[model samples]
Target: MPEEVKAHITGVVFQVLAKPGDTVGAGDAILVLESMKMEIPVEAPRAGTVSAIKAKEGETVQEGDTVALLE
Candidate 1:
């Protein structure tokens, strides 16, 4: 099954650390979000290959929004 990597806080996408076909471990940072002067990572929920990233660099994302898909 596929899993979602969601933003924990509303913020602008600071960076994208992984791309489609990238293999990642559990808790690996998939992307970073800049909120309130802090950089937060949106991480993979489990070990998987990155399927897609919906949020791009500098894009604003809301809390609980799906930023990436993992399979």
Candidate 2:
């Protein structure tokens, strides 16, 4: 099954740390968000290979928006 990494808060994407085909562990940071002058990391929900990134740097994302897909 595939797992999704979602944004926890509304923010602008600060950085993307994982790319498609990258192997990631549970809790690994897939991307970072900039909100309220703080950097927040969006972590992978499970161990899997990164299948896609839905958010890009400088893009605004809402809470609960899917940021990446893992499989």
Question: Best TM-score goes to which candidate?
Answer: 1
Poorest stretch of ten by lDDT in candidate 1 = 1-10
Per-residue lDDT of 1-71 in model 1, one digit per residue for the tens? 78888899999999999999999999999999999999999888899999999999999999999999999
Q: What lDDT score goes with residue 16 in model 1?
A: 97
> What's the lDDT for candidate 1?
0.94
**Model 2 local distance difference test score:** 0.94
Model 2 steric clash total:
0
Q: Model 2: which ten-residue window has the lowest total lDDT? A: 1-10
Q: What is the lDDT of residue 64 in candidate 1?
A: 95
Q: Compared with the true structure, what per-residue lDDT tens digits does model 2 show for residues 1-71? A: 67878999999999999999999999999999999899999998889999999998999999999999999
Candidate 1: residue 35 Cα off by (Å): 0.4
Q: What are the runs in model 1 whose C-alpha is more than 4 Å off?
A: none
